[model samples]
Target: MVEGDTFQKFMLDALEIRGEWVRLDDSFAELCQNKNYPESLRKLLAETTAASLLLTGTLKFEGRLSIHARGSGPVSLLMAEATHERAYRSIVNHKAEPFESDDLNHLLGKAQLAITIEPDKGQRYQGIVPLEASNMGDCLVQYFDMSEQLDTFFMFDSDANGCFGLMLQKLPDYRSIQDQDAWDRVTQLANTLSFEEVSGHDNETLTHRLYHEEQVSLFAQEPVRFQCTCSPERSLASLNALGHDEVLDILEHEAKVAIDCQFCGAHYEFDRADVNALFGLGKMH
Candidate 1:
């Protein structure tokens, strides 16, 4: 079957240059399907989702990468997380609005955008920057430069059709982006892409338009799909975290426990007998 959305990473080892391209379809649309988001917020969340997948694919750790936005604008908070295992989740907490300005002061209106990486074996890393980028791509590029000191360029697009994005970061020990001018040229070319084209074109076609002259090597693409991490065992563990007493109280009033997985909107229901079994009151049949 043809994959819906995918993110491809390309590297020029000789030049020590690396970049990525991403397309999101069902993997991102599933999130919006669960919630009726406003046009602006939906686009923002979709872009953030595509970006999380693209950025996290570059990490070497077995952990989670989280993108968070807290703003005073019409949309207050949006978050997306992706793990090394390829599992992802996204949430937006705000009413959808038709606000169309890309200005940081206008779109987010005095807010913070944070990129956090929690590794399985090392200390968690966090980079915080003012939401000044006219778009999410610019915000991430600013974060990479300010926090990791990497020369970075990012391009992102989203619409009712789908979401697409690209990221380029110069490796360490290289000259400045200004000195080489590659960053400026690539970004300028990237800006020429329209939402309709980015959302519709394939990776090869998009690359040809942006880097036709450059010797860009496109790697084999991987399939990206919407997968939820929720399970009965996991739901029981969450109930355990809420404490046995709380579970009993919920069972007493509601007569059953119900949990709606935020990512996939899957509902899990457990009765008193199930709760008892969960607490070791009875063995499995």
Candidate 2:
């Protein structure tokens, strides 16, 4: 099996198109290990995670990019986030029974997909689109076409072993007659990619097989890992957000307050002294 948990960028020199490939093995396993998700939900979450990373690779920002979905189905909510540094986390909230179908529309029934780009120093940008396709790849392609006015192609796959994705996008300069022809040809070739080829082969072999006649430049691979941004201080800040009275009410009822990080399952506990310190008062015995 190919070593996973890395993102690599490549440029089709002759086609004026750029692309990215990502594979998640141990990182995917780590993210899913702690959660008790049905198989259908697991696959959807994995695809979302791969899509988030693929989109994040195209941006030159210092913040995070997130893909979110909400619907009126058994799977009510699904979310995935990837930072500029390539750290990622994902979650799925759904009803307990195993889904009988893996179709995106059936699993997500009447869902809306939201893509948000948050820069470290600027206002966040978001685009919303209805989940109109049978799969995530087609839905994202539709989003870019309608929202960004760019031609894009996406292929993604995930199973019990790992998850992987490939994306090809026509750059803005691809407008000439020759460029248009090249774009069409490259996208057609990209469309022929099978999940087996994407998840089973290494980057070099895969790209070469797909675009052997074109001049392709494979860039250095960036490492991607599973990481959660949860800490005691952050949890305390959340408690403060609920107001002093609310915190006291919870503490009075439970004797101690506990908060769990949804991403990594880390637990944060607060006793009376902890709550008092958060409110700028001296600790109580």
Candidate 3:
């Protein structure tokens, strides 16, 4: 009976600040059903998933956005992707350790975070988000500073099963000094909110609690779910990269070419007939 996964957009009507709120519950648990990740890593993955949703709402596009971070520390890689329509999926690659820290330098080491935007009909774009921040949301916030675009702020919280994220970006070029002052005051009020208020309560209650004096236009919530875009046809096309001869060689040693989807844990196997059909190698019997 939980209205588990949803993404909502809202506006501080009087302040010219646009914001988004996202919560992932059943869909989040479904995404992790196949993997056995430690609780800490699971929490990180949940945050990344929520971050991906919030970021996707920030941009106006017809494609998907991917949040990817990699490092040589206890955590090797974490990635999450969400499409424009709100369909999403996420995964993480990490060691099963608790990231024990005798020190900070050894725990998190050198890491890089990149956010990639791939449009459905146009060229793809990627930005490097600073990974030095203490958490995922702050790391993404540094991206706006580096670009010198809109002043963006993010608040994110998550546990092992679910996560929530809020993002607010100032509208370009305030019309008046009052509007400018309002932006500062509004962001200050927002920053004062605790993670529990931001993530635990619904958007309407949370927004009113923070900005009771301002007019808010709360939009309808959109559904977000776990969806993996893997198909056997796509997997078969990947074999083409290896060429016919190589695929035949792989079939020589093994019974069939096997492909396993890491995101959804779906298994795909290509036998001699499947290979022959793909490579135009007529009749491999």
Candidate 4:
């Protein structure tokens, strides 16, 4: 088994193809332990978390990338986020009753997947794809095919302890017959991979097992951990968005204004003085 939560990149040196692998254990456990998440939700969140880390490997950015799944069923939200340095967090919002199935179609009926990227310096971007498939991996594959026009394949599996993902993409600027054939052959072999092999083994062992005949180069693994980016400063900034009059109006009744982060459950409170200081005014009457 992989030693810890990690994300890595790999290349089929001779096939003009590139791929990414991610496995999450401790980090995932920490993400789910605090909440009394049901078995089905934990499994889905695990895959989303792994998927988020895998997508971060494909982008060059200073900020963050997030996966947001929304639907009209009992479960309304499944969100996972990861930063450039691989810090990650995830959350789920659903009905009180436990879901009967873990399948995406049943849990999130008539849903859409959104991949949003917010670079620290550049313009923000988001891509959306309808959830036509029953699994997140294939939903992401659909996003790449329709929105990015990239030949990408994603596969995911999870057990009680860890979630695993493998992604293979055809490198750009390829129009040759050899490239097409190689892409087909590589993805077909990837399909043969099973949850037992993927969830229980390390990347090197998994890679050789699938592509033993081909020359594949595996890169060093980068660690991934759960880090919620919530703080008093950010919470204060949210209150700032409420504007001066609105803030005073809220203060008129309550002794303090309170905000709690849904992801980390961190709480921030602002009394009159704090609010007055925020707007650069004296004590409010």
Collision count for each candidate, in order: 1, 0, 0, 0
- Estimated TM-score per prediction? 0.80, 0.91, 0.87, 0.91
User: Candidate 4, residue 174: CA error in Å?
Assistant: 3.5
Q: Which 10 residues in a row give candidate 4 its minimum summed lDDT?
A: 171-180
Q: Which ten residues in a row are the worst by lDDT in model 1?
A: 173-182
Give the runs in model 2 whose Cα sits over 4 Å from its true position. 34-36, 276-285
Clashes of 1: 1
Write model 3 residue lDDT over 185-224, tens digit each, in one string.
8778877877666555777788788778988898999999
**How many pairs of residues in model 4 come into backbone collision?**
0
Candidate 4 deviant stretches above 4 angstroms? 177-179, 243-246, 283-285
Residues 1-285 of candidate 4 have per-residue lDDT tens digits of: 465799889999877788999888887877677688888888888888989998898887688999998878778898999998999999888987668887898888788889999999999999988888888888888888887688898888877778888899876654553656888889999999988777667888889998988889999989988899999888888888989899899899999999988888888899998988888889556
Higher-lDDT candidate of 1 and 2: 2
The ten-residue window of minimal lDDT in model 3 covers 100-109
lDDT of 2 by residue, 1-285 (tens): 485799999999767789999888998887778576788888989899999999998787799999999877788888999998889998888876569887888887898999999999999999997988888888899989987798998887788778888899988777753755887788788888787777668999988998899999999899989999889999999999998899999977898899998888899999989998999888555
